[model samples]
Target: MEFDLKKSLEILDKTPTVLEAMLQGLSDEWIFNNEGDETWSPYDVIGHLIHGEKTDWIPRLEIILAQQGGSKFDPFDRFAQFKNSEGKTLHQLLEEFKILRKHNLEIVRNKKLTNLQYTLKGMHPSLEEVTLAQLLATWVVHDLNHIAQVARVMAKQYKHEVGPWFEYLGILK
Candidate 1:
């Protein structure tokens, strides 16, 4: 399918609400629970998303928009949230993410980028050149991938409890 900015923004617009709906009212235990492995808990996922909000998505877009032949994006620190989210509760993280996302979306809308601009190129640290369209598309899909990850990690907390049903539940596997 062709790239549709409006459709993309519509989906991007709902990510924070979707995250809140998935996480609200859960206890700290549930939010932080994991399978005692490398998988990220819901809390960790939120922190990671927060880090992205601050350093990844919109920052990269701004670099692309402002720099001729596009500037090289700073290498993303995937684990920065471990330090950045220090002293924050899940509710605070959620609110911060929501606000940052809203601010970024407003900037995107106000820019009123044309299809030609979406084709604009930027340098990625590892991937070399990338298009604005690809970056935006990745932003949307990245949110979804993490959402699925949060669900999978949460579901796996019951890996042993689910017993025989685990084989049938793809999320558990």
Candidate 2:
């Protein structure tokens, strides 16, 4: 479906509560388990989202909205959560995500952005150039991708026990 700001906000605003309801106070087996090395645990996914809230989505949008030519965006640190998440518990991360998402959404609503504004451009570190709409769309999908990652990672914790049914359980695969 095409990006609608209202639709995007619906998903964005709900992400934190969804995550918390799914993960809050769960055992380490559910919250911290992963498929393997280099994969993110559910906890790690929350940390990564927090990092993006602080650095990625809105900051880049501001540059595009604030400039005519659009300034280059800072490269997003994909692995910052590994270090940044140290010492934080699942609850802290969830709360932070909720606050940041709420604040970002407020800013977006206040902008009263026009169709022309969504077309405003920004320089991406890797992609080179992009539009505000694409960035907003990415913001929504990025939340979803990570949410799926969390589910897949958690489901795989029982991958071995659900023997013979693995084929039917697409999530394990």
Candidate 3:
């Protein structure tokens, strides 16, 4: 499907509320439990989202908008949440996500982007050139991906408990 900025915003704007409703006030077990190894919990996912808001999406968009061509974006540190989220509570992280997402959406709207702007290209640190449409689409899908990640992590906590029923749960897979 074509990337429609307005439709993108409709989903993007709901992410925080969806996350908050799904996660807020949940116990530490739900907020902090990972799927073993290097996986992330719901809390960690939120922190990672916050990191992207501060470092990834808008910043890359600005580079593309400003450069008008071949703008090299600073590489994003995907693991920054480990240190940056230190001492932060899940509630605090959720609040931060809401505020940052709001501000970023406002910035996106302020641009008043058109089809030409959507076609504008920027140099990704690794992926070579990408269009604004691609970037914006990623921004929307990234939120969804992590939201699913959070759910999958939480669901796996009951992997063994669900026993025979586990086969029916695609999320645990």
Candidate 4:
């Protein structure tokens, strides 16, 4: 299937809005909660997602547009990258994410990327090849997956009492 830029943008737009709402009214302490472990605080996850947006997602999009074929790509190590990053606050990371996301959306929206066919290869762990259309679909799916993860983390870290609501509905437990 070909990459549907319009559909992807729509999904991207909605995902961020929901994320912002989910994060609303959260104190910096809550946003930066390290309850999950030493590796991933809520802030770290946002940083990882923002890094993925800029370094992983956008580069892949570029490769797709350039139709760069048969070259090995490096999959992003989101956790490691964010861990080493120097940002001290979630707000800064979120602002960066917002900027990158907006720029990516603009690129997708303004470009004539329909019917484009390209192949991308990755070799960080092992060699793999994917088409432009497949990559775009993956990007959308990836966004949804991370958004759900953020919701799950938020529910666990901050909404313990209310989490049972989702648990009863089978969304979580």
Candidate 4 has an lDDT of: 0.65
lDDT, each prediction: 0.88, 0.91, 0.93, 0.65
**Number of the top TM-score candidate:** 3
> lDDT by residue for model 3 over 58-91, one digit each (tens)?
9999999998556999999988999999999998
- Against the true structure, candidate 1 reaches a TM-score of 0.94
Q: Can you rank all candidates by TM-score, best first? A: 3, 2, 1, 4
Deviation of model 4 at 140, angstroms: 1.2
For candidate 1, lDDT tens digit of each residue in 19-138? 999998898777988767666789888999888888898889999988765589999998888788889888998999899999989988999999888988889999999999999999
Sliding window of 10 residues with minimal summed lDDT for model 4: 116-125
Over 1-173, each residue of candidate 2 has an lDDT whose tens digit, in order, gives: 97689999999989999999999989988998888888899999999999999999889989999885558999999999989989988999899889998998998999998899999899998999899999999999999999899999998998999989999999987
- Clashes by residue pair, model 4: none
Task: Give the lDDT of residue 27 in candidate 1.
Answer: 84
Q: Which candidate is the best by lDDT?
A: 3
